[model samples]
Target: MKQLILAEKPSVAKDLSRVLGANQKHKNYYEGPKVIVTWALGHLLGLKMPEDLNKEWQTWKMETLPMIPKQIGIKPLPKTGHQLKAIKQLAQRKDVSEAVIATDAGREGELVARWILEWVRFDKPAKRLWISSQTDKAIKAGFANLQPAKAYDNLYQSAIARSKADWLVGLNVTRALTVKYQDNLSAGRVQTPTLALVRQQERKIETFRPQTYYVISLEVGEERGKRVQANPYEIKDQQTAQGIVQQLGNGRVDSIVEKAKTESAPLPYDLTEIQREANQRFNFSAKKTLSLVQSLYETHKIVTYPRTDSKYLTQDMKATMRERLQAVADFSPEVKTYIKNGAVVQQKAVFNDAKVSDHHALLPTEQKANYAKLTSDEQRIYNLIVSRFLMLFAAPHKKVQQKVTVKFGKEQFIFTQNKIVEAGWKTSEEQRASTIQWQEGMTVAPNFSIKKELTSPPKPLNEGTLLGKMEKFSLGTPATRAEIIEKLIKSELMERTPAGLQVSPKGKQLLELVNPSLVSPDLTEKWEKQLEAIAKGQFSSKAFLQQIEEDTKQLVKEVKQSEQKYQDFSLTQKKCPECGEFLREKNTRDGKIYVCSSAECSYRRRKDPKLSNHRCPQCHKKMEIIEGKNGAFFRCKFDGITEKLPTKNEKKKKMTKQEERRLMKKYSQEEPQESPLAAALKAAMEKQ
Candidate 1:
């Protein structure tokens, strides 16, 4: 009987098919005498929305929101319905005796396959073909020692819980906010926390006060007849600094304490760390770096998994170190020599099983990379991965760190120096050429310290350090972090300022309007802790999901009753000449025209300039073919001018500063009115 194997992606399925000798490829299945391989395009079936259960739920009404289904249902996307059909047919085939799950050996991967199985009514005994790499040896061994599918029940449970929880919170909160605000403002667990962070930074930057401080520098002369200028690291108050400078007068040699300290090499690169470094060095966005890494994995086949959190390898993978090292032998000669001379030392710090999860940090695979095939950006990324891989097996880079402290009465001044002691891993020609080193113990200054007073606000957030914080601290998974950042930007809740993502003025105002506890990282962290518990088989997925549904219900009720106002700062600009009210622009089949702000006024005018046939240079105001000193001059009502201007290669661009200020003012004055459902809910809330 044929054994069917299911994988996460088509690329992975192809890899498994090759290793299993299932070369006869059909529409969606690869067949051999003893094996048939197929794949799932990630998740084929997912939790259904409230609208799927009933059509009436589509509209954003308070009564219909906070939808919590009794039995969480799953439905296939129309685009992937064919894939589901294939899976069902494969499962029911009489020739198939048993099935094998060859998808990724992770929680999400397990969920993907399991969900499809349940949806297709697959009942055959299943085995798991878990392997980290796509190498022939790894695949062969994985099949040879396939494990029981029951082993990953806990992981599957955790995955389902995560999916359901996100669905519940995301849908309920998004619908509630949209209904309450009467706009398309959406919210999610991750999105809210992310929005809060940006808004907090913006508020801080807006309210930050700049202070002016003074510093005094002394130019001291050395014993070698050389004058060296040094600044005292200590920045004291202006009064004290002035007094100290007066005491020295011209130049005085202060005691110089120069001591040498050693510095060790940095740890190997993790996915997040690499992303951060690439962002800083190349100015590539986090999402862009991930996309490049995905290509390196799926297309080039030169790197391992790119979505991993682990920076170290497991002990079991140590045997394949030689092959992995050999893949980049030509690229890094120094690493080749070390592997050739002796088996590369397996440092526990770099190769510990406890730190490793389903996959290790991104490293070179056995596949030899064709550098010519890589784009300029890919080449840069691949080179970094190669260099980092080689650096791991090589010796640690050594350096000397120097710290000098000088005492001025009760206060002390400090200076630090980083001196390279030995370029161990960095000794290789390529590494040495690429690396930068500072000189050792060369006191080339005045050797005297000056007192200075300085004060500055917090620095802006960069993509690099922010990503590092997100990944290193388990703030969110790699997949979700990029999505959340994008959501914040799209929602106009967070804007890109000189310093990282700061909440837009409107974003801060919204936070104050919404429930205080709703927009917090604590919500995500709490859910994560529960998900982890479910993964460890210590908590129930059902219990966690129930909590989410109940909390969402209460949150919706609270928001529906609140008297706070929501202001959408998106507006138009046209003054009403009759009533002096700001004109709101509305689009009709005829064209764009201005209408009175008060809908009851019913005052409107034709805004089509083409109808008048004359374009004004000042404001594009159409004129009725007016005769002037220049024979035919266009008149502009807005600019109140009639002048000749160039028409070739000219376009009017909106001035953003004035537009934003105008919108903010308009929004601040007008408060949103609640929907009828919200009004009814408020009455019910009051009675309760």
Candidate 2:
């Protein structure tokens, strides 16, 4: 009898099939004499939508909410209906004896496989094939030692509770706010609190007033300098700072305190830390980092799971650290050097069973990577994971930290120095030592100047800083935090600027209209804590869900009764021809656009010029297609050049950008051309 193996994605299924010797490949599954493997496209089914459960709850009406369902169930997702049907057929086949769940080893992955098994009515005994990495060794071992499906029942229960809770709270309150405000205002347990964080920063910046301050600086070296005062002076004390600078003369070191310090290497990456680092270094969005790392985990099969929250390894995993180091030794010279130094895992701080859950820290597989096949971004992400892994075995960074109190006239100035004792794990570049030196009771004269500064406002939340905040407040799980932040951006609640993420005009209004409790992180953090408790089997899923229902009721009621106004700053004078409704103006990356004010109407037009394929005669670049009272015509914005568009009967020459550039360069190089009349006159004058 064949064992049916189900995986989370096609790529993962292929990896499992190779190890299981499933040579026979079909459209949806791979078959061997003993086993058949199939995969789910992420999730084959999700919790049933309200519209699916009842027709009365379909329309967006305030009265229908809080549309709490008496019973929450699952339905096949529309896009993956075919895959779900295939899994059903395979499960029912007489040749198939037992099914093995090989989806991701997380709560969401458990839910993906369980929902399908329940929906398909697979009655055969089932086991779970859980492993962290997609490498061949991991797959082979996982298949050989399968766990009973019943073991993850609590985790599956937690997944259900979390999904249903989000549905109950997110859908009910979102509909209530949208219907009451007559605008597309999205609110949820996680996203609303996240948006509140952004608006909080924006408000802080708006009300903040800059204050002028002064400080005294003493130059010691050609380029090195030290601040003379421990605290900055107020604007009223500017003269006091200047007078102190003028009194600066001979300096005496009153004392010197030195302490030896050892710095251990950083812990392995959890998804949130890596995402934050990627955003800060590469300006990559949180979602972008997740996608890149996911490819490294799944497609390349070089890294362990990328969605883990733990930055530590269990006792069992310590034996494999050396092999993992060997796999990545070729990627960097430092890794080889580490191996040569006996590869001792000095920092025992990284190995703690209590700190690891769902999966151990993100780690490299025991297989070497083929760098040529990886994309540029993939290489970057791989380097980040590998570098962190190698550092775990590196020696502790040692240094001598010294503090010196320098006396300048009657005031005391502080100077500090950190001398590197051992360059372990860190380079001189990262751990720069102060070049300034002074001995006890030594005297030296230095030039001092008053430097003017100002008290700055709070910096805006970039993606990195925002992710850190989300983690601190337990806004969402590491896997879900990036998605929640992305949802805010896509919904037009926040925008990413060069400065950082700023709330849009509509987002500010939505924050004010939503329930105050909904905007605060405490509510979401409490829900997350209870969700974790449910996963640990300490709390009942039913009890947690019931709490969510009552909270939803309160949030919806507050939104319904809110007297706050929502002004459409985007309202336009022009009317939509399709629905006869006034258009609303919005600024997009392309430029300004006018969309129908009514939500039901899907009509929009670009207020700015749209580029056309008709190239300019001189630049050979595409011209803008402008709509006029008479008809449509092409206008070149660069040179203010206009050209008549060809009529229906007239044919215009069309060429690709490459062809246009090639032809323009080839012909335009022949030099200036004379008109026909001028050419004829020149020829006649030559004859005379």
Of the candidates shown, which would achieve the greatest TM-score relative to the real structure?
2
The CA lDDT of each predicted structure is 0.71, 0.87
Pick out the ten consecutive residues of candidate 2 with the lowest summed lDDT: 222-231
Per-residue CA lDDT of model 1 for 196-294, tens digit only, reads 665665567768886655554322232122112354334336666556545542222234444554333345566787788898889887888888987
| Residue 669, model 1: Cα distance from true site in angstroms | 74
CA lDDT of 668 in candidate 1?
A: 91
Q: Give each model's clash number.
A: 9, 0
Top lDDT hit: 2
